[model samples]
Target: MDDKSLVLPGAIFALFSIAMIWPPDEFVSAGATFEHLFYRWIGDFSLNIVEYQLRKILVNRVCVACLPALFSLYIILNVPPTALSTFVATAGLASMIMGLAYAFYTISTNFSQTRQVKELALYGGDVHRLMTEITQEYLEFANFAVSFAHSSREVVGSHWLIHITRFDFTIVNLTDVVFEVVRSATVDLNIERPNDQLQFLIIEAKIPHKNIKSFRFRVRTDQFRDLQDRVAAPIGMARNVILHQSLNERFVKAFVSCIDKNPRAVYSRLGELEPCFGCSSEIPNVKIEKRCTSIIEGARECRQCFCRPMWCVGCLGRIFAAKQEQERPDIWLDGQATCPTCRAEFCMLDVAFVVAEESQLDGNF
Candidate 1:
């Protein structure tokens, strides 16, 4: 075959390498496809075991690195010995060597059976206990990270903290560790509202013999309170760090609490209510009606929203919060916000539950 024939195999190999490292949504979402292709041999191995997961990761990497090399070698053997074939052979050999070296390094650092000294360095005095904790029952691996009840394998543990990446796994003691929450600069405008951005919890630990010093873990604003209750160590009072609630999130809670006290708006049971426009996962259970005494009290009159009930309470709360002055959060509830579907203005007092059937209110509503 001509040198031009190499194009197909080369392109295929390149795509394979990319997919192995950064798999597309189909590979991730389709569990059967992902398991059959990647973990076909090791599918039966218990994910709870740290050793099994480490071995799985190491095997995956080796495969990722060596598969391309094997493809290159196949091309060299099939095609005539040209300069292109010679170059392919050289690249194949290099790839094999790199993969083997990485495998060896991983075995030495992560595997206790291979290198006892590294294990001692990792666990120190609690070697036996910590080793047992890690190996016995870890949660299912989520992208090389495990999730326990309070902490994750990639973040905090009861006594230890671990950071697992594609290439490295670093673990450190929780002793003398400092935690700080900071605002994340990277914002997904499509996913998050303009005012409510993301935040991350930084875990800085003192590792004696490790190059890694800190790990950044994502913490959702709504789950912060629960996290605080679960975490043993108090968050550090450091400069430029905040563990307080995001304005939008705080407003959501308050909005829900206030609107819950208001009377329910009766909708016709004949009409089928659709899923929320803001978050499609939930049913539209809220309506914007002028039930508040603001109009009688001589405040800004709240117009009755003629739009259909198309928003959940949580989503409506979010929209209401997002429309308010971001800087003036104190006056947020007292202020008015225009309905997302209709331009009619309404306050938190006007938000009400949509009850189609009075009987369903006790159970599903």
Candidate 2:
């Protein structure tokens, strides 16, 4: 979840309460109590839903983040000023109560969506249409920075595909090229949750292509290339979308703008708003989607854009491996791990492939 969204509600509630209390207003004490009660209620709600194991999570969030805020109040109220530890403990307790409520809020919101999807699906309603409506009305009506996709994973829930957006598909496939070179990234989601819905969404065109499609790539937390050195392409935030075949047409148009400029151009130059941080050996290629989007260009070039795979089906491409993908040429080679077509020397990662002959050392060891 984006930090901004998570904090918005609480910030609003806190500020509103403060506004009423300022300048010795009529509601100062009431407003303070209201603020406390509101947050505490949210904390309680979250705690109420927590299972035996997940309860710890609620406590941790309260103690680590929420408690500090409350302790500030404690320092101001204590006679002769209590010890820092006293303040800390009181704040922690207060924050825990508030955090519990927030957790409960989250659980309720998630559960509401799950129920909505289940009820809608049972009636044979269209998941995509519902997703579009919810995203437009509830998710990103004002915040273009936000986008949503409908996705479901077999783990932890039923066929719930409703997720808020920030998806991108085209850039992901391009990134996969680098991932394959790094020798990391095992396509486990494909094997484990074959039917999970995954969509890539891009917000307004900060990078020129609006309505970018979700990066319909599988998450492979297991595979790690150069694990010892932490040398691999940056993994930007990617949500788990239920595996889907087709994406929205508006989404397609946005992605389409980023594709080949020339008939010969294979790979698409998809861009991203949120790139990874701290690592610089490899550039943030911001990947793309393939399966959900049509590949006017052939395999090697097409796969460079994050080509999403179909349900229970996968492209045995080299994006996850060092070997040449049998079906497609290495158009997706924009990673730090030099591509097979390296003779072009800085061929610009998003450009079409220039197939080079296999060169081997004079003698094999």
| Candidate whose TM-score is highest | 1
The sequence of per-residue lDDT tens digits that candidate 1 reaches over residues 137-182 is 3342311233323223454545555555553455555564555664
Query: Which segments of model 2 are wrong by more than 4 Å?
Result: 1-82, 104-321, 324-365
Model 2 lDDT-worst window of ten? 308-317
lDDT, candidates in the order shown: 0.64, 0.31
Q: Tell how far residue 184 is off in model 2, in angstroms.
A: 23
Q: TM-score for each prediction?
A: 0.53, 0.20
Model 1: clashing residue pairs?
none
